[model samples]
Target: MQGAQRNSLRLLQWMMAASLALPIALFVFASTISYTSTNDIADREIERTLDVAHEHALKVFETIDRSLAEINEVVRGLPDDAIRAREPALHQRLKRLTDSLPQLKSAWIFDADGRSLVNSLVSPPPEQGFADRDYFLAHVDHSIGTFIGTPLTPRPPYQGARFFGVSRRRDSDDGRFIGVIQASVLPEYFESFYARIGSDPGSFFAIGRTDGTVLAHFPRLDRDLRLDPTGPVGQKIAAHPDHGLMTIDWASDGIERRIGYRRVAEYPIYVSAGLETSAIRARWYATIGQHLVFGVPATALLFLLLAFAFRRTQHLQAEAAARREAEEALKHSQRLEALGQLTGGVAHDFNNLLTVIRASVDLLNRPQLTEERRQRYVTAIADAVARAAKLTSQLLAFARRQTLKPEVFDVGERIRSLHDMLATLLGSAIEIAIRLPAEPCLVNADAGQFETALINMATNARDAMQGKGRITFAVQVATTVPDTLTHLVGSHGFVSVAVSDTGIGIPAARLGRIFEPFFTTKQVGHGTGLGLSQVFGFARQSGGEVTVMSEVGQGSTFSLYLPRVPPDLLPQRQAPNTAPALAGSGMSVLVVEDNIELANFAADGLTELGYSITLVDNATDALAELVVDADRFDVVFSDVVMPGMTGLDLAHAIGDRGIGVPVVLTTGYSEALAQEGRLGFELVQKPYSIEELSQVLYRAARLRRVRDGAAE
Candidate 1:
């Protein structure tokens, strides 16, 4: 009886472990995936956000180009004498032109001698001719197109303002040296407009000549300021004068920024929209934080579940030690039965995780995981685990025993939102069409399971089509149930999400058993045969049913029919947590363990991973160390089963005194520690390999970072 009970427990434990590890492992991989994809999303977001500024700058320059063209046309027709005779008329025209474009500070015509013939603000031209001005000198020497000059002090009637010139050189019919047409634009106007684009203090916008002359800028400085035209950014703009986007080293402020730039079609001016490097990555860091919050606990808990399952066997083995050992043949027979019961995707994913975990652990054994990679994988696994858990909720979910988290959602809108992801997922070879209704078809279901089913269906379609074809997702309302939808028995007023693919159709004979567990027509390791079953299970659980319509050599359509909710019901969306990353930047750790070997292992791992470590033999010594210098370490890593005041006691003592550093306790098995319960410290189980050691250390370090951040 004892032997049979032990064997049964082993079988059950392995089954539970298989259930636990697969989901968490899947999440770790998803988290690993975010390392590449989220950064890609962040890059795309940066471009999209900066484009707002780009469009604004583009419009500003276009306005300048038009003003330049109109001024040139007027100056070209009227020679110096023509303007002198109708000076009042020309000033009125110039004033009207300035009124049309707010960026223009003043508009005027200057002769070859650089004396203003007529000015927009003053009817009589200012005596201060711009002969010394760069634009005036360049036109005199016969420059053409547009010359964007350095900002100048506002002369005479426009005394309080500063202005930059957009001037064009006009000549006689025979091309003799003539006067220059100029529009002096207010940088403040552009600055005020750019302010509407973003409120982040560090994000600034600028438009300048390709030669590096600042035409306009935001955060309006009261004093005169002009950037070095030949500086790093100026040279970059010069190199790609037509238009470009790049990372630039700002010469004036020396701050690095990611810039999106484009040259105004008909002007020498180039517009640049830029955000600081930190500002651009702010979203990406938030994405990472959201992933870590869920992922870390999931990864750690996954290990704990496996530990629970295994430790039961260990406990039984200790009790059975005094009794006769089980026969190898019997043990082999039990494993085979368990193996047969849990084959396909669950096992496959479990194996994949072990492989990755083993690889990561081996690296830790070598103690070579750098701080960045260490933090990434740790956070990734934690984040990814959550999704993986949702993916594998098959058995009890299908049995209808599990509670449904039914929320009303629009099938049509959901399908539309998935367009980009579906495109990227299917790749270029496969075309994806999202056929969503103008009206939303609301349904009640667990959003995660619903999404998972759709993803699985898409994956199945991809494999069936051999990765090259069209996959269409369509949503519609079904007013009546059909005789063929017997499995969906009571579903009424249904909303359907139909996924159709132009792939080789499923054989009629195989269709009947397609939803059965472990049944697959594909080669080993390719199809788990759980895809259709999940769809079927999810449909039934959501008070709906799945329908399959296919023909040989023709495409296949799998429709998920879910009961429709009233139009009055609102849909829910999950917002990602945008928190700062828990960064471990050379924090000191206190390692307390009774065992010399374990203490050495902990200290060595922490030290090699770039953390300063102080090791003590017992919790007594740990308390002394902390009492002597409370601020000595950022995190305290203690062994729970230590002699003379356990790690829990040290934690409680720390809590009482409010020593403040986060306590991390490592253990193998302790009834006492478990009973102590909720020590307000992180738990890391013992007999840890290098991989396990690193995970706990990362946890401690992460907690310390969080604590320190709160303090700050």
Candidate 2:
């Protein structure tokens, strides 16, 4: 019966999986067909574009030939000595030719020696010589025939002007070559025409000489129109001579192009049209992408419905089982809740008394006390502080009011930095070994809480070892998380940290309750039993997990798993410096607090740091002082909660007045501050040491400079 049930489950899973896979397989097949068809269509597009270019190029050459014939007839019909005898008539005819053909620049008649005899311009002819010109040489060599020459640059404003020339060799009655009749062809006319030819921005047309000197190209400026016959585009052109269609990257921009070209057999000119490969591919892919956008989801939905229909009965059974498990979990949670209720009340009451003891101890450990008494008192106070820290950590587990200031940092680097401090805390009696991966395993969490959790786990390992064994901390990445911690670590990725200790491990029975608040295996006075509980609370709060595995004789391993944060998203870490602090340089500070003692303490600290201070007890008084003398203070240090108005309200009021004074808000977890979670002004957490205050003061001053736009 069990085997049959297992087989049935397997069959159902296979059916569900097949239903899911079918749509994906269909999509893959459809995508292949779509892409192949798109590519074929793209090739047809390129061919059609090339055909248009070819027709344009044919018209260009035919127009040039027809224009050459017209000029030749006009020149031949005139008298042999017409230039000298009737220069105006010859010039008028030349001008007429230029007027009819906009591409035609100007016409000139050159003497046998190639000096300008007559030109189309009415103005005086400049003393120009074109004896060395290619058109002049070509015409002189060809008797009684018109010839086309390579493109050349004329003088300004036509200087560096790319134009071809048609020259008809003037022959005497004996058929001897006389001075050439030349007409300049401006390639700009072809360029402008080609610019209007295609819709694709990347597609371009070009007219080049047989030797590969470009006469003109549209959609780009190519001053040096020379193409290297050795290059990819040049070689591709060379390989396909008559009417070629090939793909190659043009050297100018190195963009792959599907080029169609036609070699002008009647002349040295050739025309090329290049369609960008990327543009063609984009058109192809966009069609397929559009199909996938609508088709894929529809296909997936159909398969999903089929799978769900088939699995409905099994899903109902699973839901019934889950409800039963949830009831059992609720009862188990009630028992844990009862235990936590008693523990929480005791921890909360003890916290208040411990705060008084901590304050009294701080006042007692002064210079007035003898060195011997001070040492004894400090040691006793340190022990009590440790105990109090443990008790508070345990109470924090049940407290929903704890707000985390989460930041992303490398867990490996952070742990490595804590090495020296952990060593001092653990002492030389125990060995500490650190093993970290090559790269940082970044995680997002409150850095202070993370370090505290590490210390707590280390402290437990030390006690378990009787203060004399090795502890190892290893950092790595976890591909999968356990079911117990699935919700905490989440799905993106995670950093795994293993804290192993070579110590006398806990018995299996006691291991289950180790993370419970105040559940200690040690005797009274040894521990408050909150170390592991704090670690558990910290891990859960940080959107991570903490778990333990122990063997009685062997050792124990506590693993902390944190969700990985990308390096780019990691927040900047700022820590206070312990070096000689920067003094305030006679700056003025306004200290505001509802409590007189706290205000005085803050004022004294600023004064000692070389800042002059004015104290105000409450936001109402501070505002009154500021309104009276706004320029007196360089910085404002205000406590968050005040009787009349909060510091946030005061800051807003200051903004309204446009006083532009920098305000720093201090708070010790009040409902006012806690509700907002973060303050508008620069913040320094409460109960901060003098060093931390100094650093924050510097930051506040820097922020003031920035706000005032006076930053250097």
Candidate 3:
């Protein structure tokens, strides 16, 4: 009986082991297969999304191109006499052109003299003259076929809204240039086109000029928004022009997104489409969850059977614990990634605000005033700008977008000059130490930004110590890492600057994210979460790297490794200077600006400087004024943005009208309008102080005078 009982016990144990082992092994195998299948599904979904985006983008480009091509064909076929006749036949032809292609808002022909010959939307005898339009001159070259023109406010004050023109040369039957034909498309056309590309509220599309000026966006967001792609993923997209997809936190919408971007390889413009990652990943989660639901019950059944036979629940429990740990880790990583995106978005907006403030302050300083009052205003402006400067420095540092203005400089000398400032910044509660090498170290970097970075790091160190601890900054040149320091050395040729502090060391959980933007332990108002990010950015931008070492009780050290600057390239030093005095003989000028206050100010300022001034509210009035005295004005000074006719069109009209006057274009936001090497005239960016205005006017007048003298 005892032998039989023992045999039964052994058989039961064997059965229990098999039950536990078989299902779990099967579950793992099934799970692995499921995961691989899910991965493949995700990849296919991404590719499909990309394809849809690419197709939509290409359609927009083709639509614009085809619309322009149709207008060009009509223009080439029409005779100058027929277009110039200003009869019902001409109006009918123009209307037919627009009717056939609804995308075209209006179409018109301009005679060689810059006068509107035939317009689709206007009465046959249209009163407007094109003698001063940029498009007229831009198309005159003929080499630039089917080009996009700057945004144009329509001609004749009460007639049209803002539109962009697509122009091609109008050639006679004999191939002689008789005139130019243009198709003006409204902003609504682009808005509608972008709208069709993406319907998801979370997905947005933007059509921007090459210089980053956004022309149109679907679900139009704020006009003030700017996109900077200097971050790791942004850099990758820019460097690789091929279509690609990635999950990134979009700072603009404050959402994690799986963005797919493709450069319109055929068009001069850059357009991109972005979709929310949540939307794309939601499907994957649902599918995975369904599988998990079915598998979990089966898994539980297997465990129960094993428990009944073998009494070994501990092994099963251990495996569950391990899976939970992995899931937690993945969630944490996702959170950090989200936080980095938020930081970048905040930084971009902050930088734009700083730019506006800085430009305003710079303008304020150019006028003459009483010494005491001027000194106060200057100091106040400087102080405010200094704070703004800190934000920009941090942005550049974190984004690695800081423009390098490198020159040879003695790093040691620069640091020594900041000793007094450091002492005040550190305060009496904190002890400070500096270790420098005996030899001078030269570095190539932007000095102002470099100084600001050092000060920021020092301030952070002071805060870490809670205003009462020791901080040491050591700078040295070493051939190799000493055996004493195995924990913080890397393989590279470097000059090291180590800032160590005896304060609360970073928690192990947060250590990995210490350099991420906006990952802060400080109270809301106390930090922007950009300090260390900026430090990391600056180091990388300066051809260096940063690393941190910390232990809970042992404190922490932040080390920056900067590559030594080559001897051939050193920093340049500049002496203080003032703007050169305006130098040119007085000449007649036309000032076209919509803002009454600004227009009056500009006209008065120009008149005071002894230049003859003609002022107008829009391109129509400017053309009328010029017709009255076409040869009187030496230059046309106009604002780029206006209610009816933009400054660019006004410039083109000036050229078209057979007036040889030069143009000095001005704008508050000229990025969208100004095309480098194509304007055929000068540009003065707005909110301009008297001095800048005078200088630009002077340059324009001088150039015109020289040209006239050559003609003589």
Candidate 4:
């Protein structure tokens, strides 16, 4: 009887071990399948989103091209004799052309002398000469059938309406040039398309110029919320054009977002869409939770039944628990990664604010400060600001929150400008030599921030040199080496800016963490430990890489590898024009601002500057005031972002009521308002001193005078 009992127990133990092992194995298999399926689905969804965005952008370009073609056909309809005579028949033909196309806001003919022969709209004669305009000059050589002009805000009197003109040379049957017929399209035509994109409530889309200026956005939010594409992420995109999607912690939104960006293949613009990753993961989490609720109980019951049958099941149970723990560890690692990104974002924003304050305080110390008492106050304020700036910089570097504005500039010129300052900044113990090409050795970088990065690197080099050593700075076009070859395949371009110092070189072990924030080798109070980190951030933000080469006794070299901007596509430099003076005395102005302090300050400043001011806190009150006496105010000075009604809506209202009062918009934010393209009014930026307000007022007054003179 004893032998039979032992045999039964042995059989049961074997059965129990198999029971526990089977379910755990199945659970692992299920999880693997789920993860793989989910990953594939996510990738497909991302691709689809990118494809849709690309299609939408292409449509916009096509529409603009078609409109230009239509304008060309209209210009060809004008008779050669009518063009030469500049007769009423020509005016009628232009009017008919504009009337037929709703998209064409206004059409006009300008003679070779820049005289407006005929205009679709009434009231103004050709007093302002267009001969000096870029469009006019561009047409002198390429007077083709349809020449598309660059985007520009039309001058005042037209209230700075943003329009791109399409000009065509009028020719006779003999193919001789007669005159030019131009059609101008209002910015509204392009803006209307953005509205139709149907934006998600929490998500926003922005189209920005290459320089970080926003062109358009859906569900218009605060202008201050506009993302600077020239910031760090933007530089990354420019440097690695093929990096289709990236997840970045965006400080403005206080969240990590999966950003999808694509450069418009045919234009100098970029389109980016961001979706909050947390929001996306929330749905995934809910789905997983439901699965686990069912999975956990079923899994537990199977294990419990197996334990009753088997005494040897403990070992198998341990293995299953280990696998689950490993999976949890992987999840925890992902969470930590996300946390690091969040910290970095916070640091970037804090640093930007600090930089602004530091620059402002520095400006206060200029000789422009005349009074001794005022200067003393400014100095005290500067001291406080400097301390605050230092604290924020430390926080930023620790969090890795530095964004950059990158541009292509001559490295030689950039260094020479700071030569004198560097000598003063560093003692005579350190010798600095700059070796640069005579011709412009251009590297894509932000001039201001690049200077700061260079200074930080130089300071580090000086410190390492122990107050006596030579530092050499060199600029050159990048060349590929076998071991250090970059992944920028098919590209024949790059620029390298290098700084080398004969100092105590970094040890091999410490070199890797040198770019990390708050990682310093110096004693306390000697450094904030942000110097190298700032250089790293600056390099990354400029869409480049920062690399270090060091040896114990041979010293160290730091190289910043940046992309090069093509020569033909470089930004054009336009000569500055003096601000025109106000042409009227005793002109009454209506000031609208939501901020009471700002409004009152503006009113006081304008009143002192010779204009009578009527101040209102909102657009509604301003409109009510206007209705009471529409003719009282000569111009409406309003803020764009307000509580009830926006400045643009107010301007539209005034236009509908036939109030010919000119509108002057004032805002601290320029991106959104600028994108609106000359809302038929002049715009002045906020935080303006009294002098700037006076100048803008003067310009508005002068514009009215010019318009009135033309009317007479």
Rank all candidate structures by their lDDT, best first, as comma-separated numbers.
2, 1, 3, 4
Across 406-485, the per-residue lDDT of candidate 3 in tens digits comes to 55666666777888889888898888888888866667665765676677677777777888899888887646543434
1 against 4, candidate with superior lDDT: 1
The lDDT of model 2 is 0.75
lDDT of 4 at 658: 77
In terms of lDDT, model 4 sits at: 0.65
Residue ranges of candidate 3 with Cα displaced over 4 Å: 1-382, 478-493, 567-571, 577-712
> Of the candidates numbered 1 and 3, which has the greater TM-score value?
1
Per-residue lDDT tens digits of candidate 4, residues 200-244?
323435555555555554434344334556776777777777437
How many backbone clashes are present in model 4? 5
**Which ranges of candidate 1 are over 4 A from the true structure?**
1-32, 46-59, 68-85, 199-204, 218-241, 305-712
* Top candidate (lDDT): 2
TM-score of 2: 0.45
Q: Give each model's whole-structure lDDT.
A: 0.73, 0.75, 0.68, 0.65
Q: What are the models' TM-scores?
A: 0.39, 0.45, 0.35, 0.37
| CA RMSD, predictions in order | 38.7, 25.9, 47.9, 48.4
- Give the runs in model 2 whose Cα sits over 4 Å from its true position: 1-408, 419-433, 467-470, 482-492, 502-513, 550-555, 568-586, 607-617, 620-630, 641-659, 670-681, 706-712
lDDT of 1 by residue, 1-712 (tens): 6777678777767766666677668767876676567556545655675567667766866677687787677667676788889899889998998898887878878888888998888888767677788778878876666777888887655575677887888788888777787888788787888788757545767777766667676555555545666776667766877766678766557677777777766666666666777765675567767876987787677768767867776777666754535555666886676467456457676676666666665555556668888876666554445334443455435544333445678888777777788778877899988887777788878776788788889988998899999998888777656565655544347787889999999989978877766567888867666677778887876667888888888989998888887777789875342322332357788888888987887667666667788888888888888999978787888887767798888999998887877887776555564334444567664444455555656776676778788979
The residue-by-residue lDDT of candidate 2 on 1-712, one tens digit each, is 4466457667767766776677678778877887788667766776686677667766766776676666666666455467567677767877887888787788778878887777776534566778998888976776635566767878643354577777777776677776787888888887887788766757777888777777777765756567877776677766776777777777567778777788765666678886788887787678778877987787677667756764774676567568768977997897788578556646654765577567658767566887777667667666665555445544564242334566788889999999999999998999999999997788887787789789989999998899998999999998767677666554457888999999999899987788876677777657666677778887776667788989997889999988888756655675643545658888888888888877777778767989888887878888888899888778888887777798888888888888868888876545554445555567776655566676677778767778677644
